[model samples]
Target chain A: MPSPTSKPRGILPAALFAVVTAVVVVLGIWQPFEPGGGDLEIAGGGDPVRGEALFAESCAGCHGEGGVGGGGGPSLVDSPIDEETATRTVLAGRGTMPAGILGGTDAVDVGSYVVQISGAVEGAVPPVAEEPPLGPAGEVQLTGPRLWGIFVSLAQPAGATWTIWLDGGAQDALRVGEIPAGQTTFADPDLGIGTIIDQYNRVIIGEQLQDFALATDELSEARITALKALIIGEGNPPGANSLVSVAGEQFAVFSDHTRFLVEARDEANLANIRFHSEHLVNIALGAPIADVDQNGEPTNPGDGVGLLGQDGREGYLPQIDAAAGVGTIAPLAELVPAVEATVADARVCGDIASVEAAGPCVNAIEARSAKLDQLWGQVPDAARASAVLALERP
Target chain B: MSVNVFVADVSSGYADLMETVFTSAIVGKAWLATAAIVLALVQLLSAGRIYGKLGSARILSSRAAATVHRWSGRLAFLFTLPIVFHCVTILGFQTTDTRVAVHSVIGSVFYGAFAAKVLFVRDHRYPGWVLPVAGGTLAALLAVAWLSSSYWYFTEVRFGF
Candidate 1:
């Protein structure tokens, strides 16, 4: 019944197929192909229940039960305020009202609930904003308090080793005397131009209006110029600026700020260092620090005070704090110093000029890079990896 | 109403989990797609050997090669299901731009071509050129799908892990 030419069935190909199939299936299920870690869930619709609970705890005393205007707060019930306006009101606190202490998602959730109870369930859920195009780098606003924290954190035991490079000044401007954290007497603070109270009520220096400031004392003039360009602009005739220009310019500042912290051998500015470091981590992972207005542009532009719009600040503070509390910021904070040290050592190597002299610096950079890789390998989650990777390049 | 709820629940469940998995890992979707393409190449080669297109070398007997071709084709097809499910149920058939439009069109045709190949494979009564045409069309569609997506991802977004 069988032709003589028909070859007998071999078990090898079938066996190999089974083994390969098994491996592929296992790999799919285990998802071991992920280089860093699992994927991160971008923020989406808010949980109204959580929002309601947050409102009861923080809003009920002022706005009354179910947001029915009472006790000095206007009623949100059937309130004509749209979701955007409500979000702003809750975050910034209208008139005598204080800013809400809720995170961005929580704030949005609360806004949703208020809209729902007001019988405007239609359009209660706001449309998610599309990711802005990765435009050329432009000037980013870095906060004075955070920069001061980075400076103080990285300071040697004697004090922070660097001086602030101000515009229209012949030399780097050094702080004349110790200005305590809450003091407001100094004419100019270290980072920015004016003085203002941070969300913490602690008096802090204003935004750094200068083109750039030295992130670390050891940085060469070229590196300083590069870092400054990243912060403000390259002074490249208007539209030619880099991605640091219009969107997420804070990231560039944060990247260099963390790099400066690498040489920090003291605990003096550790708290400040951690605070700004956490902010950088949150922003990199698509956290909204500022609310773009209806025209899809940054509201309160050139406000010259807070990094975020007045309303955005209310929401930004708590979300960053929450991100810090959960240890999301810890690995990144630790990794920043390592990256900073490696880049600094590389710079030292580059300064040697002569190839013979440069060998040791090159070797040191290579070794430090290997160590950095090992540290990167130890990162436990994808969210951390995403944030870290952004800093890894620049 | 219940059906709509079920569909929403299922779509959200898959979309949220897969989106996280897609964006979190660096160029992961691209890499998985690359792996699928490599398997597809193997399917193409084995299919050719079965058809005697590789001259008279006869690396595999007709029976053995045919069996390998069938199984490899099945596996290659199976490899695309998750990606297809994600695209269809979550992303839907979007044509937002040129690249996406090309990808969506090829992706839709790929399933149709694949169905034809499977049907042809089961039936030996088809014309001589029919099976080859079906197989060729499926492979070509997959290549376009890969070119529009994974290739673009690697070159433009990121190449290394």
Candidate 2:
């Protein structure tokens, strides 16, 4: 009964099918396309939970439960580096970096998992906002033996608790206090010098004073001196100080004290390192005090003045972030001769204070350095890769 | 109630409501619920306009409409009873929030009015008194739900939700 012009029922069905097909084709052309980055099946699918356990075992000694570094390592949480970059850095050792901590399928899986969990990759060191002068900062009143322990754990809750107040001078003043987790507190009084903590455990101000310290006005000079001393002592010292001797260059014994000097390198680096170390110290033994340990109390040693007796504490020891990485501190006794030689060389040739000129001394020590390579050789590929990432150029 | 208890109740009640809405089964019985809600709305609206005219010409003259409205309302209310019970026992009792109590009160009232409508219609007498009761109860129930739901939606949904 179909009309001649309409054709038979079969034709009607075909026409309808043709129309639907045309619509689908048009839609396919008009819709936005997403090109596949490819299903890159890595050897092992990095299990976040396993990675977490591994992090606690091997990495936690430096990187915390949250991927933030303590002691020798730098923070890995919220790192800005992409997964690919992080993977590559972890695989290949860089300056002062150990090779192959995370290699093989396990390394790939762990690195991939870390990249997945760390939201935003960051530079070598987290940048600090301009802080105002807070008078004498880094002053901790450690009376009880347990006070040091409490201070060590202060920043563990996460986020930034310490803030900087500018005194309109070369040395920036930082106010150490407690802030709630996951909130940001500004330094401005009107804005409430203290606010809340953020996703990074960086509270504006509140809770216990996570250990803080002051930077010398001559920050660069201090860093250069410290680096020179460390390099000569640990990098290429002579005789009994030698941890390892390659060719003719000799390395020195590493100690907590030596690492402290290198930790206090730059203003920003110093703050982060100090904050990290304090958290570690708090976690380990409670607080950093003189009588509490060999360092002597803040009150003792002429009311805690001068370098040895300074009232403020030193190092963010507990925060072992692999990114910032830890430098093996060569003992001063073994390194004195090399340091003296470098000093003599610098005095004879370039300015001792010039950080730029100090490079040669650091390099000479590095050239003779053997402990790092030895350590790198002992660890698995994944660990070596992570160590490499730690030493990568900022 | 104490200030703490009051706040807890309000928060718990809101959470309970959300859980019910999200997890409810809308399949199979959708028609029954939809029909009841529609009839209840119409009856409530018509009653409001009439100023308490239940057995008046407007309703009595529309037998088909009245039957549909009456039957649908009763069936929906009957269906809602089990859902209410499940929600109360599962989500309501589990939380300390007082809002659960408020929800229970409103839901009970809704069922009460609905039951009265079913009874009135069953007896074949319009039961002039039952119409106002149903209408008033529906209005109160709607007010509570609308206010609470609207406030919660505005606060959470307007920005993030």
Candidate 3:
């Protein structure tokens, strides 16, 4: 070997090279970004008040009293879809469930509702279950009239009860027993409409059951009398249930030709459900009577009760006519003019906020209109003639 | 007669002999095939005389390299002849019926052009043009083969992208 050389390889350069090599190795190993995966924001918390309402209306029926599934649905209180995963599950669809469970604007509404009551997230747990109702469960006599008032508050009807007071009229002393806790008591003409009071006194509208309500006009009286007959237990032997069938087009199809269709949102298909679930709540308590909507078809004929006429007979199915039933939607018609005028005003004014307000207002009015139309439609002609006969005799 | 003499004279049996000679040449001279292309490029630089402007004698020595390059390119065509026969017999390009008729014709044209390039090398003052044309034709043929096979003749159908 030549004389031992004394030249520096420079510690700094070597260290720099080592650092760069380390960086490259780390970069290769830890590929931080992956292609093809999509991005989604997780659900934050939601309003408990809104959550409670949604639970009562949508989730409570299937998932038992507190997100515990009863007969038909799986309990969700400690389910797989925790907050982060719940958002993902809803967006992507789980096992057999399809997407958009509650589509349109209600999608957000319903999704927030599910996350709130699911108890998988913090800050939205259920209230401690209360002790069974204080009074004896046996002597708890919940009459039709008593049930109706409790249902109204529990239902959270769109406007205030006073609004109903202005429209439906008031009545006097009525006895209601066997009420559930957190329920309202019943009085004659619980709502304050004039005809409602008259009908209560006259007994044309009997001790109102949860299913029955006082219609605002004579036409409605005729319709309800006829419809009450076809219901399963109506005037039939004790314990008889009604059987009805309605059909509609299929919604989705897969490669195996298995198609998916639904009778309602936030409600399970009737075939795979139990009576004490949220789905039952929707069917028995939440569903409105099926009626011809602006599309001139029953808003939900596939799942809704068939309409009857004023004469104690089933109503004739009429073709949708824009003009004929335009303002004559017996129970729901009053809101139509305001809605129509709103649409016309939006056309004239052309301001976006005004238009936005107009659209929802129109939609709300339309839904009401559809309900009244359906109720009036059920009134049989014979009932109309009978009422006329009853009036003429006096 | 010697095999080379018979091939040079184009005798009746020479075509069969040519096939044998060319096949063996391809196996042994595959490396030469790569070298031949390099030599051709060197010859081009010399003929262009840019090296001569630099006053290097290396440019003057490119004549043999030019002759060999021309001969090797022509030999490549002979090597390709067996490929066609192999494709037809083993790959089944030719028979009573086949769909790749277009492929077969394009392949024949490619090989034929390669042979012509070698034969015509001595005639033109600037013979490099043939090399480029042959290269372009070979590339196009490869592209066609790859695309048709990769896309399955464009038969894969679906709803959207």
Candidate 4:
């Protein structure tokens, strides 16, 4: 080429080199897409040693010697109740149980012991099954206190009512009133904040016996409660040899909804991503009791008994945060307004207007949502299927 | 239209696509880098043959070596594009650790060297050994980049996708 002249255009190459270097520097500073799928060593909190005696005296009466059930209560051994929910339930009570029988720390310990014995926490205990406590389609089955939560959910709607025949042992009193929906009431006066539903209506939290159908589309809360009194007059879930709406019959809606939402993450517009995330967190914990999180001005009755609340398990949210590798993502309690602040930085900054510019925010959101998916794995399939029924009614 | 939306779509979509073939994007990158390294090996051998450093009888003919060198270099460059896409656009230059810092530092200048080499290919005003030296430097940079990333990925992380 022209006898290969000794003179070279140094300025052009230098300019090109400078431009490329600048591009890399800009890319480095402007964005950071973190990698997922690493070792998430989730060391659960709470000790089991403290929970032994508490489980023996307080829980053994109904749950049997080792929480095996076949007694007054369903089996807690090998069943699904997250530690947080169990701790709260032990502290507050559910169904026939009275509240404040144990210390807050011991409550966690009791739940942990139950969870360990039940093989709910997976790696914490030996592997019972290869897969997690999920159905084929990844669902959690609700039972026991969670079942009572469903029973309570039937009466939680604004107009729904239950004529509770408060069995004060010697069959003393009957509370036939408005009683309000989703209030943590001292139901039996001395029983503290405990859910007491003794017989009457179509609302059954457990399908143990099945045939629990009691259509409550228009039944007043009192009427519904009275009907429940008749069906389960003796108290405890009615025993049926077979079932119609078995382990997630109409519950396919939740699985489908969750799948759509998770898959939608790929093509998410980001505007509603945070909204859905906050919705999920609220569903896990309630503000003014069993109200659906972020649904109405005062929180609608959606899925009551958060997965992290009483009857679920403890340390669930913290475990999720640990797995995320992001450290303390959002508010743990169901504080509605503060949730929006969590995503304010990503959305408020007008300068971040492109994919590259939105890198840090995208990274954060992805890390969080992915970890939330892991939380679902802890829930049993039956609980997952049963929990969504709150959304099926008024 | 919004930055968050655009990023969410691109990053998740890309990750989901990579996950379809491999376990994750990181695994996909490891395999992709290995492929690039193989192509780079072809470039090295072919370049040696073209430079008469390698015996014609022991390797391909000079013309044949030149053809192989051109094609292998092009292919190697092509193989690195996706990796560069994920590293620069998605992960960027991370310096979380010694290995990562080295990878980031070497990776940042990789394209810069490519730009200089491209310019030198056209302009013959440089010394005779210039192109060879540039090519060697690129290979060394790529080798280190592979060591810090793909090698680390296979060794420190899981070996399988």
DockQ of each: 0.05, 0.01, 0.01, 0.12
Tell me the lDDT of model 4 at B86: 74
Indicate which candidate wins on DockQ: 4
Could you give candidate 3's per-residue lDDT for residues A134-155 as a string of tens digits? 2111111111311112112222
Off by over 4 Å in 2: A1-348, A351-394, B1-75, B84-112, B118-133, B139-161
Alpha-carbon deviation at A74 in model 2, angstroms: 36
Candidate 2, residues A251-328, lDDT tens digits: the string is 112223224323433332433332323322222222333222222222111111111111244211111111113433
What tier of docking accuracy does candidate 3 attain? incorrect
Using lDDT as the measure, which candidate wins? Answer: 4
Q: Locate the minimum summed-lDDT window of 10 residues in model 3 chain A.
A: A247-256
Could you give candidate 3's per-residue lDDT for residues B1-161 as a string of tens digits? Answer: 01122212322122234334432211212223333434444434444442243345553445664455445445544544433333322122222223244544444344444443333333343334654554445445534432332222222110011
The CAPRI classification for model 1 reads as incorrect
**How close to the true structure is residue A207 of candidate 2, measured as C-alpha lDDT?**
18
Chain A of candidate 2 gets a TM-score of 0.23
* lDDT score for residue A234 of model 4: 30
Off by over 4 Å in 1: A1-394, B1-5, B16-32, B56-59, B159-161
- Fnat for each model: 0.00, 0.00, 0.00, 0.29
- Which has the higher DockQ value, candidate number 1 or candidate number 2? 1
What are the runs in model 3 whose C-alpha is more than 4 Å off?
A1-284, A287-394, B1-83, B90-99, B121-130, B145-161
| Candidate that scores best on TM-score | 4
- Tens digits of lDDT, candidate 1, A1-394: 3343554333433454455435443443343212111221213334566667667655654454566543225567765655555544554344444232232344555665666656566655422214321111111122331222222221111111212222223343433233232332222334433211111111111112112221212233443343333332344452134222332243344344344333221333433333333332333322343321122332221212222223344222123223323345344455546555544453353233344444454455445545554544443232211111000001
